[model samples]
Target: MTSPHDALFQWTFSQREHALGLLKAALPRPVVAAVRWSTLRIEKGSFVDRALRSRHSDLVLSARMGAGRIYFYVIVEHQRDVEALMVFRMGLYMMRLWERITRDRPRLTELPPIMPVLIHHSDTGWTAARAFQDIVAARGPERAALLPHIPCFELLLVDVSAGRAGDVVEEALTALGKVVLWCLSVSGDDARLEREIGHVAAALDEVLRAPSGLAALEALLRYLLATHERLSVQKIGGILEKAVGPQAQEAIVTELDEIERRGRAQGRVQGRVQGRAQTLLEVLTARFGSVPAEVSARILAADEATLVTCTTRVLTAPTPQEVLGDDGPRVSPARRPPARKRARRT
Candidate 1:
């Protein structure tokens, strides 16, 4: 079975060059030219472990700019959903890179800047770092406050659900975006989204055959189809067949099928465990008003049989106190716990 980490690694490495081209287009002219002047190295695995400990980042690109006098690092983290830890993780990576560079080149006068870019397909609004208080305080109270300003991370948020069929390159990016959004969307009518996604997929098929775009498109499509649960290999393959050719479509389908089989097996095991835990928690909450944090944690960590038994007890228990063994409330099963006390904590 291919782990999420493995899948992510494959996805990132596959599109490393294509993503680099996109980044180059977005960078300042001098920086882009200077960076291009020197060799751009794609470093993966333990090389970047000090910066990003996990394999979640799709690509890490580093190059020497300014006549090979300075080193610039760009870390691209890709995701189908919003992760709260992204900010902290990027901050950690930046700090680690700085430390390593300084330690390695102690005599250097200055270090190059680091840019963290998030390529996300979430429909949820994206937010960057807040600088209101910091900016205001920098000039207001203590002129010497001297707090280092937080670096601004760029967010390339493309929500496919908001786009329509258009230019090939734009459509390709949108289609990739939609494929991700489709995977993450869990509510309402998905028919429209699916239809649009198919259109994008068809466009991607043609892009994959083009000499200039073929490699990148194939890599991106492979990654999207493999990691996203919403995209089936058959659907994507059909699109590829229409866009590219049967031979390429067959190869992609085979790879996707293997990935899906592994993912499904793992998902089934996880789902069973999660379902039982949820059932236990629901039952406990019903009978005992609200499950305490410690109790909930215990439930989550409990074995499957234990959770199943707890669920059974919850269904049969008449009152809150019965399930909790006399320590809980004596309220009816439908009665909820106190508003303030029952609120869930992270």
Candidate 2:
């Protein structure tokens, strides 16, 4: 199963403020100073290659400069593995974005500039080429001569693996950025997750003070419960209670109960619909080689949609932890971006 990191990473950036803050912090200081963060806007309905949607997940955010004539495209890459042809893929996506701009403004003659930023979170650090030209095969002077024809753009790479947990969480400009980077850093390591709960909880309290903080807190709690297997609902809720307040703890417990209720209710219907359950069990058995009783029991009880999601993830997920998506306290909210009204358009 694919790691839930993709979904969680996308969710964190879906917030306009979080996206802006992360870009400012992750980019160079000089670059950050030049842009008008106030004008930054996430360009919705701007993705392409619909048929290859499962290949990757990306975010396209735009901000204007110089009387709105110049714009910047911040394309975020959140894949786990490094793609050597990333430059080519970025080039293709940029071309599609430019085409989209021209279609929207037929009178324009020049396309706005775009800065591609790749947010990589692999266990191993990124060793791939940063510039598109690096991937091109040409020898000696031929490479220099062809430089004019080849794309020379350099993508800003934010390697999550290359930072200390303390520095990243403490220094991140946005609360959401801190939360995400911290989680990503400790994703596969339950020991680190437990050790750093105090720090994470402290940062979360700061995030919880704002008006929209509760929803963000809820999302974070859900993300933790889904991804961290060693964390129990009581354990997580206790950490949150100590860090935030009893209110937060109670909310988390309530959500946990709801998820369990839904899962079991779906289980009954699944038992009656033997065909889909059988298919799911077969897939699980093939991958895990005799699924554990508890896990098999869950499959027998899960709804068709959850089974489908698990099946899709099982194809690439390395462990039952990933296929189940959440092995801790609760199931994740439906596999979709959190629904909220768009912020004011730039």
- The backbone clash count of each candidate, in order, is 1, 4
Report the C-alpha lDDT of model 1 over 1-346, residue by residue, as the tens digit. 4434334334543454544544454455555666753366665532345344343444456766654433334433334345655555555666677777788789878766665544433445344432223323356566445444444454333223234112113422333333333333322223543444454455455444455344444555555454545756666555445644665465566655666787799899778988888877776776667677766777787777766666666666665334434455556667856567565889
Worst 10 residues of 2 by lDDT: 161-170
Which pairs in model 1 have colliding backbones?
287-320
Candidate 1 Cα outliers beyond 4 Å, as residue runs: 1-16, 44-58, 69-88, 130-193, 198-203, 206-236, 239-346
Model 1: lDDT of residue 243: 48
Stretches of candidate 2 above 4 Å error?
A: 1-3, 46-52, 69-79, 162-172, 229-251, 254-346
lDDT of 2 by residue, 16-79 (tens): 8788777777766665677777878777764535654445567778775665533444444444
Residue 83's C-alpha lDDT in candidate 1? 62
Cα-based TM-score, every candidate: 0.49, 0.66
The root-mean-square deviation over C-alpha atoms between each candidate and the true structure, in angstroms, is 12.5, 15.7
Residue pairs in collision within model 2 = 1-313, 1-316, 1-317, 267-301
For candidate 2, what is the TM-score?
0.66
Q: lDDT for model 1, please.
A: 0.51
